[model samples]
Target: MSRKTVEFVFASAVTTNGTFTVSYPTGYTKGDFSRGVMHRLIALQSTFESPKGITCSFGASSVTVTYKGTTTIPAGSKGIFGFDIAGPDTFRETDWKKQNHIINRPAILRFVNFGSPSTVSTTALISAATGTEMPATAASITYTYATQGGSSPIDGANTDGKLYPARNIVTTVTHASSVPTMTVTHTFLDVNGNQAVETHTTSGGGTSNTITGSKAAAQLISTKIANASTTQTTTGATLNVGFGSKLGFDIPILDSTQIAMEIHDGAMQGVWRGNEILPFALGANEVGTGGVLRRIPAPINGRIVSAYAAVEVANNANNAGTIAISIEQTNSNGSGVTVAGCELAFAASATIGTVVSGSTAEGAATAEVSTGNQICVVATAGFSTNAQFSGSIVMRPTYTVRGTLAVADITTVPSGTSGDIYGTYTPAFTLDGSKQVGLLVWTPEPNSNGTPQYTV
Candidate 1:
């Protein structure tokens, strides 16, 4: 790289605030100067008092330096200064190319002495400068699921029949820059409440961060009911067992079974339950007794979102009955109040091994299902024969937990004097040959011989 040095004597020595302009070569503009180059120029120091108190500002095609009132320059003497200017090719190339070529133009130092305006001292300063390159902005974050080691259906015991356990899930956050903070949350259905929740938080300055957490387990309830030989009219059977312990389960049963299921919060207080009745005649309303199916621990406060019951009827010569499944909440008096229900009627010729299902949305009214509730199932024979059926009851509840992550704000650089120059300089002397000051802009090349290349 080649540098152009030009010097001009002051018309008159400056004793008060004044301004001087340095115009760039033709076809060059301020946009060509990189922020790194500008910063280097601003750090230069001069022995002469005039350039000491001077502040520089950039323009489209020139630089204007404003001097304070306290600055002074000797008459008919030499003053030296050095700084980097942009070259035509500086803006056209990449940062790597610019750094390797030292593309900045040579420095032009002009000193205007008092008493000798026409006798200006013009000197071109040149040098090679290099420094570490810092990132200009932060990078965005990337997220993904980490490998989870475990078995499905997380069923702790075989007695619970295929009940699924909570899932242990992990999520990783990554970035090219640094990640200061991160938060992770897990949500799932709860048998005791509307939902179950878990959360995790982490903080550090690095390229990556990981958050580990797990979802709540789902609940399942399974049982078998035999047909009633006598024409049952009321909920007469009693199976004392805990229900809604963790989450809820589905009801799977055979067809032609006259049964009803009910849930309560111990104390015989009904929480929710359903029933199925067999018809004696072709189109008769099947009626049956409601009894306690299971007594379960009270669930956390939450609303029921969904409830369903499925019945599979076996092929029988005489099979004419109706199946109904329902979910209800108990009143303060322990009475059952239906929130949602599903019913299906079976014909005499209904195909053997046929399946019928019913479902209702429980989340609409935000129905509350308290803890320690009792669930019951009852069966009724429509006519002389009892319906042979099997099924399960499944319910899903939701829980919520929240978390947040915030990054610190960046501070701004204040405006003022940069600092004293780092290199050496000689005082201006009139008797010596037009004294010269050279400044060359250089940047170290990582691939080269590790020497800074001078840019003129």
Candidate 2:
């Protein structure tokens, strides 16, 4: 009934200073996973992985891992790569520890379509940082990207709070050099207090500029680029590439494309048959008819961000009442606090309009919720007829910048020329990590409607 969960443990001390790689069984089915994504990669390589920023991705029929942090992933460091993405119920994680030189972290993975040679291919993997950055003189224009709070923005996943906690970052530039040259450098600082740097410089001959670069930090890590600059020197203002300049300038070389992705861990919503009996039925408006209550729990520590309702079956024209959907927090005393802004309301006076309706507010004080807390759902109308409905409450991971930057080889258009790559912001040149991330859709949940959808 279930595919045996698989594992591949290293018998010897495996080193990941360059890049570690492994091949999966041919035609293997990775269930529902967003694999080969840098930000989506999760690891326990070192006691503190935030700074390490371990990235995982798949390529060449194999998975690769790139360690971005400076600290050595000590032997015995667990959860080096969370390969348990086979099924919805199997998103597993190991405890985090402060051990040094963490090595031999075993991978517990699950998969389908393991054809012949049902084992993983352990190729000699080299661990290395992604390449990307630079500087110049003569009253030159300078731009420095760093934490606005005077700390390191990369020091996240610091569970014990031993590392710096500055989240907000900013950049400043000085304008002066004639026929000035643009220099950009991204330095990867490790927990060991060392550094790995990438540099680039290009000839500049302008007077106005707009340069923009995209960082892989999740939605929570919105960066600020300020020209807290020291006024320019000459007529050449070349920094103005494009406020929204197309993201380019591949360092080392542009061998791949950088994708922006976000994954929601929970949908605190559900569907219901509005024509059912008493409590579940939509008699009239919500004033008297107690709407059906579905306690959808938050899977992780997150905030109630959005809410919406959709009528599957068009309601009668007489249904003039409004439908209000709310997500509440259940307390120890069994009481509920309506999460502010996490509610949805729509006029049901007309027939089914769009396939879906309503939205939610995010990051409210009352909107903050914990794991396992109930996300109660309620719906009502003035006079509801046969209006079948479905609703949802979106909950994203609490941490902004949900995933690490998978700074892979720029393989987009032109492979790239052997020259410095300039940028408006930062780049810690960690290359592509093709980690063995597998997600399966086996044991599909068959619904009464005769359609198939995976429900976790």
In terms of TM-score, which candidate is strongest? Answer: 2
Least well predicted 10-residue stretch by lDDT in candidate 1: 123-132
Tens digit per residue, CA lDDT, model 2, 333-427:
23266656644444455445443444445445766777677656555435454555555566655432222322323212111121111111111
Residue-wise C-alpha lDDT for candidate 1, range 1-456, written one tens digit per residue: 122223444445655456665565445455543221221112113432223344456687666656543546444434332233333334343544542434443332222111111121110000110011101123111111121111111111222322232222233434445543423233333322233333334354566555433222232121111222243211221111111111111111111111111112111211233332212111112222222222333344344333333333332456455544322345222424333443455565655365555555645442345443433333324422333444444444333211111110001111111111111111122312232322121222111111111111
State TM-scores per candidate.
0.22, 0.25
Candidate 2, which ten residues in sequence have the lowest lDDT sum?
121-130
C-alpha root-mean-square deviation, each candidate: 36.6, 21.4
Q: What lDDT would candidate 2 get against the real structure?
A: 0.32
Q: How good is model 2 by TM-score?
A: 0.25
| Top model number, lDDT | 2
